[model samples]
Target: MAEHAEAEHEEEAEPRPKRAPIDWRRGREQAFSILASIVRWVGLIFAALLVLHVIFVIGSANSANGIVSFVRGWADGLSLGFKDLFTPSDAKLRVLVNYGIAAIFWLIVSGILARIIRRIGGVVSS
Candidate 1:
């Protein structure tokens, strides 16, 4: 029928939609989201950090405060004491510890968001 031909013509004539320009702000937003993801990933769900803190405290009981305490000393001694210049010990232990703490912290944080959403949902539903 003529209607069928007309419909086909209309469909073919319609131009394809153009994609919108990415808001550069979106890239910044993604960066922030990534940071937030890292934090949440470590803080809420890993839940093992509390245990690590406790263990670190107990295990290091003698040297207990040594690591944390030495943080200040490390700052003062940095230039004199290898300056964290990619020394095997610094690269492996310190970097690994920093990354581990960050990851666990973010993982545990995700639970906080869940709790918040649940509370809000309960309020909204009620």
Candidate 2:
């Protein structure tokens, strides 16, 4: 009876299964996800900067101020030539429309690029 019990205990002590090797395809998918997130965040930041600049202009913030100047410089560069796309008689309205359109453009372009990247990653995984 004792020998039978010992044999049963030994049988129950089987080794755990070995872990599988890391999958490079999964790593590629993760890399693509990270890239997409970065693109999305960059676009969001650009849009935010443009909107902030618009707010500063409409609120008549001092152009000579350091913060205003910095934001203005960045916003101008990110405007993609849309800064002066319209020539409304009212300066405020012009900024509103042009910068607004530029902001929307960034958002849309980023979203599309992110989606495409994710799709490519999915295809590679499959």
Candidate 3:
């Protein structure tokens, strides 16, 4: 019993492992990653709005409809002045081409911006 008690005392005397310190750089990187993700999501949303507007126009959706008008309004604003970039004989084709270009532009620009932000964050953390 005494030996067992002495063994228990020895076990209790051992030091516990120390935890690693919190890294603020890791937090900064995580913040940058979240920002990049948000940027990508915004780009996707803009592209989706443009595509939805194209669908509405092509399908002859009623412009008077609130949802259709809302989408059209947002798409027009997000078009980045590409609405009249292309002139086609058919109105539907014109909208398709111009809006498609705008959507692609947004996607590409956002991707580039996100990459830049990530690189900046990496450099700052380092």
Candidate 4:
């Protein structure tokens, strides 16, 4: 009887499973991915707006149209300092100089920002 009781007690004391180690490098990578995606989305939005502005300028989109008005307003706000970087006498060249330059500028700036964000995330996760 004493042997049986000891055997039952030993059986009940099952060993616990070991926990999997956390992969912090993977976590950092995930963080960087999410940040990059957000930055890319923002960059795309700005690019689209600039493109629209270029169309509006080139096509002479009617300001009376709500969509045209809205796009122009947004582009005006976004271009800000970039609006008159080059005052080309020709209308087509002026549009390209203003909206095209702003678009390029936004793309470069957003890429730099994404890099910075990824580095910060990596440092924090590590």
> What TM-score, over all chains together, does every model reach?
0.31, 0.83, 0.83, 0.75
For 32-118, candidate 1 gives per-residue lDDT tens digits of 556555656555434344334334444454443665555433332322323343435533355434434444544545756645545
lDDT of 4 by residue, 4-111 (tens): 999999988988789999998888889787988799789879878988989887888787999998888888888868888899899878877888889888898888
* Residue 59 alpha-carbon offset, candidate 2, angstroms: 0.6
- What overall lDDT goes with each candidate model? 0.50, 0.93, 0.95, 0.86
Ranking by lDDT: 3, 2, 4, 1
- Model 2 scores worst on lDDT over the 10 consecutive residues at 117-126
Best by lDDT: 3
Candidate 3 accuracy as TM-score = 0.83
Between prediction 2 and prediction 3, the one with superior lDDT is 3
Tens-place lDDT per residue, model 2, 3-23, is 999999998898879999999
Q: Which candidate model has the greater lDDT, 3 or 4?
A: 3
TM-score, candidate number 2: 0.83
Candidate 3 lDDT, 1-126, residue by residue in tens = 999999999999999999999998999999898898899889999999999999999999999999999999999999988999999999999999999999999999899998888888888999
- RMSD (Å) of each candidate, 1 decimal: 13.6, 5.4, 4.7, 3.7
| Worst window of 10 by summed lDDT in candidate 1 | 74-83
**Winner on lDDT (1 vs 3):** 3
Where in model 2 is the C-alpha error above 4 Å?
1-19
